[model samples]
Target: MAKPASIPGLNPEILAWARRRAGHDVATVAKRLRKSPEDVRAWEAGDASPTYVQLEKLAYEIYKRPLALFFFPEPPEEEDPEHRFRTLPAFELARLAPDTRLKIRDACAKQIALHELTGGRNPAERLVFRDLASTPDSDPAGVAEKLRDYLGVSVEEQRSWRSAAAALARWRESIEEHGVFVFKSSFKQQEISGFCLYGEEFPIIYLNNSVAKTRQIFTLFHELAHLLLRLDGITKRDDSYIGHLRGEEREVEVFCNAFAGAFLVPQGVVRELAGRGAPADDEIKTFATQLKVSREVILRRLLDRGVVSRQHYEQKAAEWTDDYFERRRKSGGGNYYNTQGVYLGKRFLALGFQQLYRGVISRAELADVLGVKATSLDGLEQRMLAGTG
Candidate 1:
């Protein structure tokens, strides 16, 4: 059996961040930490203690937060000192599993700054949101097609899937007043990997700026689902399981998953292939290669559609995971998503950076908002001007 994950006595700040990041309640963490929930609470509330070694182990598991995050005394404020991106002291909590941490930090950054960036609700806006919420019988497939057409992209002509997705996002920019940009950050202290926040105006999806291309592609589709559904919230999870969902969030998750599935690889085509008869391993591989998506994604869709039974799907997924990673490792280079540069498309980055450059926002302010340096902004501005950023 696998060894159980341990937790040390965490300080209140670190404990609180860990609990929230892991989405584990106090009682649950207490069990993992080998203490009562109340004991864990006291430790988080500054009333009790966990030893240093214990803290280290606990920090390692929950959000992969560093022991220093717990010991830092005063945490960094939410806003970054440079004003490029929101200053995130809790970022250290994200360093645990790099992929997972990046995803979580992306979510945290979105949630923390969404309100300020999106601003107060407009009266007309609420009605629009209400209408969108109430709108029924809306065809999700049609929505996907509409989005595709709006972007002036035909699935047939696509070479780079990430580029196609970015183009779609760019098209989305023209219709909405708020800025959309692909954001990336190396969250040193964070434990999770990606997240999203639907703002009153601009809804941002943050990806763990540290992961490979295939994963980023999934994260992008996942966040885009959040945008389409118009839900406001944050999500932090590893791809360990499908997801941990509850309340309205579950509905959104379903929608997003559906949207991603349909957008990345059309369901009808997948269903048709599966209907043809039992697909060989090479067939699955060929489909993944043609679609330019991870094989695991292809299997997941097949499983969801009942084209493959649970046992078969799980086995195939496992095999695909091993093969995919091996291929990636052997390539000795970046994957599609990573090579695509930032997760956000260049068009949105240009728009977003310009919004800051035109003196609408001070350079310093822009830097802090983006979690980049002023010098970096200078380079970004030049890149945007060149239409290549």
Candidate 2:
């Protein structure tokens, strides 16, 4: 049998660079590529090379990098996750699951797509992140009220929505109307509820579609607050790290939590619902579901109002946080195209198709923008028109 031909002109430094960037060592790459460790070492040392097929697998499968990166003179400069999420501790950033990293990476690619699709300017008339900029130390309640007013969504209108799903759809549309592009994906790391990447013109929130709609709604606001503060953030199931943050970082995370709660269920409304005293567990659970408010937010509100003790709140919240997550996993299954629509989002899909129709982009480019196979575009558009996506 002939030995596979090695592809020449590929930079060995970039091969090593990509591997290190992806947090893998020589042995790991060798194992994944089914090659001896010495072979992997030789490839990175410029003494040997990988075949085109080997390079393709290494670029796409092992490192999750673009194929062209291997041909570059040197590795491109990308922001370190630690620096991007300034508030998160080094330990916290290190704990990010591999899938979580990929989702975040994909989210960045979507931002580039947005910039290219809209000619470097946001299509929205007003960009909320730029307009609503605030300090981490700013009054979260005031900021929440201002954001809610800017969104033009009121408590009465919020309650008027027939169901949580309807409210989510409306809130998502309203948010997109303001400039932030919201996208959804199934996060293999259930601990990650959602995250947001702040940008000048294309700030975005990426949510975990596997979570309950209530948690998703809360996460949207939590991440929105981060963007409003000109910061990138992650909302996780295990949020105990908030306590570990110090000074400005602590304030930022705390503000995100406060803003989401205040925006979703205002204090006055919660007080009114509680009436004479603290709400019962059932009432908290019921109202949380009906209004698409999170149980954690409700309990936190009660804790703030001197209704529930901090101890009670903490214990109860810890107990209930994982319930919906597991239930969501068990119940997950749906039509593929409809699911794709929901994941890519309506506004994004419409914009991509509009570009394709105008001849601004080709079918292959449209597929990358939508993150769908070119052949799958027809089925996705069908669902979008039927109002299911």
Candidate 3:
């Protein structure tokens, strides 16, 4: 029997570019493709070529790039991974997990889709990012207060939500209403709490849906703070990256965290709650529940007020994180369509579906842009109508 034929005259440079762009070295790609590293290098060096089947797997499976990308005369331009995340430490940026890298690519694609969907204009009456800018010297709480007032969701209104899940939903809508599109994905790397890509009109906050509801809410504001400052950022489970920064960069990192904490549990309220003395953990926990925020936020505020020692606050924060994860482990997975709808959110889904209904985009295009399979489109739309945030 004749062996499968290789594609003649394939551009080895493009194959090499795709692998590097995907953050995989030759050995990693070769291992995943079940090819010898020498053979893979030969293909990349133009001494050999991959068969159509091999190329297909390389395009869709290994590199997570389009098959057409390999045929381009030159690799397309994209935001530099390090440059896009200017606030991320060099150490963290250099060692970004492969899956996290892909998530960043996924985020860039969504930004491109938004441009195509909206005809290069934001639909919101006031685009928040376009209107807001911050300096390193900006007061974190002051900016957060301005943002909260602009969002128009009063603290009294926040307390009325009564549950973090409900608050997250409302906060997502409030942000979306102000023109910042929020997206969620179950990150392949759970240590990534959230990240945002800043654009003048279409700044996006992508949260890890696997995170707890309260933490997600905190992250929503944290990422928003980055957008307000007009910089892209990533939030991890540990913020040790902050320690790696210096000067204005360090200030910006500190500002983002302080901004989020202050935004979620405003200074005045926390101060009042803490009163004349150090509040007990039980009291802090009660305030957190009432505000639909994480205990860490309440504790951090107390620390800022000098009512709680740093050592005590850190110990409690660590314990709460462990408890949260244990509870999450016991909770298990949720319904797929519902999760997807919530991830994409109704604001984004409406844009795609409206475009499809108007014949502006084909069903396939809608599914492609939404990152849902065409066959699953109906189910996703149904969940969108059922109103998952």
lDDT of 2 by residue, 1-106 (tens): 9867667679999998888767677898899989999999999999889988889999989888889989998789877567788888888888777678888888
Pitting candidate 1 against candidate 3, the one with the higher TM-score is 3
- lDDT scores of the candidates, listed in order: 0.54, 0.86, 0.86
Candidate 1 weakest lDDT stretch, 10 residues: 80-89
TM-score of 2: 0.91
lDDT of 1 by residue, 65-86 (tens): 6667776655545422122212
* lDDT preference between candidates 1 and 3, better one: 3
* Ten-residue region with minimum lDDT total, candidate 3: 2-11
The sequence of per-residue lDDT tens digits that candidate 3 reaches over residues 1-389 is: 96556676567899998888777888998898798999999899887788898999999998888887888888888876788887788888877767778888989999999999989888889878766678768999898888878888788999999689999999999889989999998877777898999887688999998888998998998888888888898888777678888887888888988999988888778768878588777888888998999998898888877888989988988899889889888886888888888888898898989899899999999999999899999998888777755
lDDT of 2: 0.86
Q: Every model's Cα RMSD, please? A: 10.0, 2.4, 2.0
Please report how far candidate 2 places residue 310 from its true position, in Å: 3.9
Error in Å for residue 168 of model 1: 9.7
Tell me the RMSD of model 2 versus the true structure.
2.4
TM-score for each of the candidates: 0.58, 0.91, 0.94
Candidate 2 Cα misplacement greater than 4 A, ranges: 1-6, 25-28, 35-42, 273-278
